[model samples]
Target: MSLTSPAPPGGGPLRLRDFRLLLAGAAAGQAGAQIALVALPLVAVLVLDASAFQVGLLTAAETAAFLLIGLPAGAWTDRARKLPLMIRADAVRALAMASVPVAGAAGVLTMAQLYVVALVTGTATVFFDVAHQSFLPHLLRTEHLVAGNGALETVRSSAQVAGPGVGGGLVQLLGAQLAIVADAIGYALSALFLLGIRVTEERPEPVPGASLRKDVAEGLRFVAGHPLLRVIAAATGLANFFAAMLMATQTVFLVRVLGLRPAALGLVLSAAAVGGLAGALCAGALGRRFGQARVIRLSALVSAPFGLLWPLSYGGAGAVLFAVGSGAVFFGAVVYNVAQVSLRQALCPPRLLGRMNATLRFVMWGTLPLGALAGGALADALGSRAALVCCAAGLLLFPLPLLLSPLRRLRDLPATATAVTAVTAATEDPGRAGGTPGTPGTSGAPVGTEAP
Candidate 1:
């Protein structure tokens, strides 16, 4: 279906037409992107004969863009129409990816070029992700927020499960550079589809005389001070820190330590994706049965211990056990992510949505580079096995801050009055009460109405 139109007004479950199209677009793009990510490294290793340290450096380069550009991108997103940002990002990535084949064909492809392409594409991705998320609340009724976010999570999980296999297959059949062509095509297709959907974004219209810095600062302050936001920033930042470390080391551990073939790696990764999908699907039910905060806390608790299993794989029956453990950890991550997004959207004010997203992402995503660098360093010094163990242990301790915070006790989110009061108390700034970062006016809205 055409994706250019806003979701139909009669929003029900995520089965709505525009919603499905949106999900489809996101999935296609993600599947292709994952394939590219996997293929790029394989190309580096098998084709270019890069070492483990080199691969780690590539991953570090890719994520460095998020660290450098995420915050400013958020500011730009707050002032811009989010959809356009997504579209442009897709377009830019498509072009960047398509360049891989051209460079390879010319016998000019080099490790440095690949690193540059990865970094540039990733930088574009940061903006696209921020805008895409910022666009979600406008697409459905506030009450449907959790379910909608769940749907997106399902797509992402499915991509994780399937994308790697496709990437590996393409790499095997068509060569890694050619496989990257699929990712380029996916981005182009995503942009074409997204271009069809129309959205009425809620950007703050430029005042007769407002400075860009002031506008950006306003968004930053909201995140720095908001109650739920403060907790979310802290929690997600830690989770990402450990996750990045794990990701940096996972390939090495699986291939070298566990002795898994590329095909087996795909299957194992797919299993984790399946588990993650299940967790996303169950998030809403769990939230309804328990409380949102309770679900978040429980998921964190359950996921943290499973991370330790990664280090246990020494190639025999250990491989099987590690795969199962990885699936469980991924499952919990999916659940936690869905719940977190829903909570943020529900708590954030409309006007400050872009800034809030940017701020949170800046803080959370900033850990990726550090984690990548540390992961490489740890592996070099202590071996991949030790590095995996360290990351797993780190995961266990990651949630302690969240669990000890007031976020653990938060139940049904307070209405506007109490929410505003909380925000005011948190920030010690009364002027913020009526503006963009204030408590949303609606009661009984979706818990994450402002989350993007």
Candidate 2:
């Protein structure tokens, strides 16, 4: 369970007990989230009789925390033991989600209560996700990062594949309000699984005179200064904005425009996520064959055009088009995510992982609330189908940032940030350079290069 210890006889991060525990916890948590993804909006639209704008606002509430507290969460995550933080976050989310069912049973559930629960759970999720990503390096070797991330994504994608179907069924059988009880139980189970992880993470060393503002600023500077990271952030942020639009409006379109019931809606979502599961399965192999940089670039470019199919979708047989388009986009997204997230983790210094992830999240996810609001407004002004058209257009444009960047010329990403810095420095000086970028004689070995 120690950081430097060898993996058990089998290959991959799964061979490690701590990693298995972490993966299990993630699986449980993601499954619950997927269920809530279906149940929450249904409750708002169905039971609460919320308008399109109101539903959009509720969706916005779920992600607003990333914009509000994202940077500071990273700094705080770095300063504490990540496992404990993750555990506490799960507990907080469980309590928040559990209240919904309680309120529903008491005949007191309202849009206001749902908003409060969403906001509270969203805040907890910000902390949990930051700590979770930061904690991975502590349990696995550098070489294992891709496989580790791939495994996590696989579990997440699997949950996405199954959870909504189950959630929809639960809603059909037990109603939306009662269906959320599953998410509460899921969070509680995730906390228990995490409690079983045996790895002991040491507290991060305190920096002298390090204020929260300074720490936040340092993380931002690092992300902004990195050429590839900046481009990745931009691409991801842009994609997320449109994705948020889809999230905000999809339920309305499915129910009002397409006239699908809760059960059928879940089936459609599960089908869409099948592509994400496939992408997660293929990510590691694709990275090895096509190169991570190429995969990152091509994944979005090739699949994004399918998003145009979303707005074109109609009822009955035409609904299948929505699933097809969504599946293709989800596939591309999962592959892009696995490759880029592994690259970021490999490139960052351990001391800065929390802040680095937090900063990037703020940039990428901060757009979500705005996009949700936009989607809602569009749905009100034009219609759900029109809102989807705008979202599809935005998705088609998402890959432009990556395509315009140096990633277009590279096969693999740089081994580390230090290697990138060295190359940047060398490129700037036409008169002096002796060693190759990753060679020992260069600036230094890649900052986070680890023993196999």
Candidate 3:
């Protein structure tokens, strides 16, 4: 129950009851989300007979909250308890999902209804995720971050392996709308697991006269001013934008262009998830052996080129190409994520963790709606194959920030931020303490000096 105490030696944080319960909650939520990823679109495309552009709009609506409420949410999270927020978010999503089946049964479900559901659920997810990231530092020590993240990623990958297959089966058997009933159940289950967690946290003292705008600006400055965080934002922003494009288009591409059934589509995704499973298992070892920074760069370099295979995909045999490309991308992404996220947690002061994580999520994920719109427009105008090419090409560009920045100059990054010097070229003076435009008052606890 005491979060500050160290995990038992050798057993690590996984041995703790609360951490295991937390992990179980995450696993359940992830599985449910994955199922919805497949089911939601299937309902729109198959049941509602929506167009490619409409599907893109649906995808856009799902992620648009990151841009809409992301900043205020971050400020609010910094002032609140993470666990209870996450529980509430999950409960909200469960109710939202359960509504789909209720509406469907009453014969009132529509694409418009689907859009509202996506927006509401997605907004809840944004809060849940930010709080979840903030919650982990309280749950485990810095040394165990990578291991804990890797374990969680393993849970995610395992869910990926099973979720799509299960989702597809449910859709085939019970209908897509009813399939979402399972996702609702899953969220409720995740909330139950969260309730069982017993870790108590001391809330950070309130900053006197801390306005939302000021708090958001401080978070922005922290990320924008830090050398490592700057590149991470840029690289991930690029990757997430393109990844959204792919998400916006892939279901349409798979169903329309390849002429695959929903069941086959799910199976293909499940097969691709095997690579993610491998990546999750290997992330910690690769980070340790190759050095965390190096592992992030190398994984992307080695696997991204395989994505080019996607545009060249043709028929049943070409389905193999799409699967291979997807698998490789997922592998590289999981490896890069485990290393970088751990690094971020280690480097950030605990007081700023919510804001820091929120800023990253907004900048990185905010592009998703625009990218989804673009992908949909491109597919409508140029065809899905060309859209696929854009996805692959964009994946290759994400590493440019890393490859060109000072991150590449190092072997392994330091474990703590106190050892890092604050560096920025964003303002008129390249080396200013906090170069955030429009942010007033003294530059916050200078980059990396705040207590964890």
Best by TM-score: 2
Q: Pick the candidate with the highest lDDT.
A: 2
Tell me how far the alpha carbon of residue 219 in candidate 1 is from the true structure, in angstroms, after superposition: 2.0
Query: Better model by lDDT, 2 or 3?
Result: 2
Residues 1-452, model 3: lDDT tens digits: 12554565666788988889989998998899889888999999999998888999999999999989888788899998888899999999999999999999999999999999999998998999898898887778767788899999999999988898888888888888999988998899999999997777666678889899999998888888777787888888888898898988888999899987877888878878888989999998887787777887888788888888888877686787888888898999999999888877777777888899999999889999989988888888899889889988988888887887756545576443333443223322445544222211111233533344
Report lDDT (CA) for all predictions.
0.75, 0.88, 0.83
Per-residue lDDT of candidate 2, residues 66-123 (tens digit): 9999999999998999999999999999999999989999999999999999999999
State the local distance difference test value for candidate 2: 0.88
- Runs in model 1 lying further than 4 Å from the true structure: 1-16, 200-204, 417-452
Model 1 residue 236 distance off true place after TM-score fit, in angstroms: 1.0
lDDT of 2 at 375: 97
* Model 1 lDDT tens row, 1-452: 01244445565646566666678789879888878767787778667877666677778887787778777777777678777788899999999989998998898999999889888898998898888787787676677788899988988887888888787778778888888998998899888778766545554576556566776676677776566667778878888888887777777777777877666665666666677878878888877776677677788888889887777776756677677777888888888888888767766666666767877888888888788778878888888889888889888876786676555545544455455445444445545444323322224322333332
Residue pairs whose backbone atoms clash in candidate 2:
none
- Cα-based RMSD of candidate 3: 5.2
Ten contiguous residues with the weakest lDDT in model 3 = 435-444
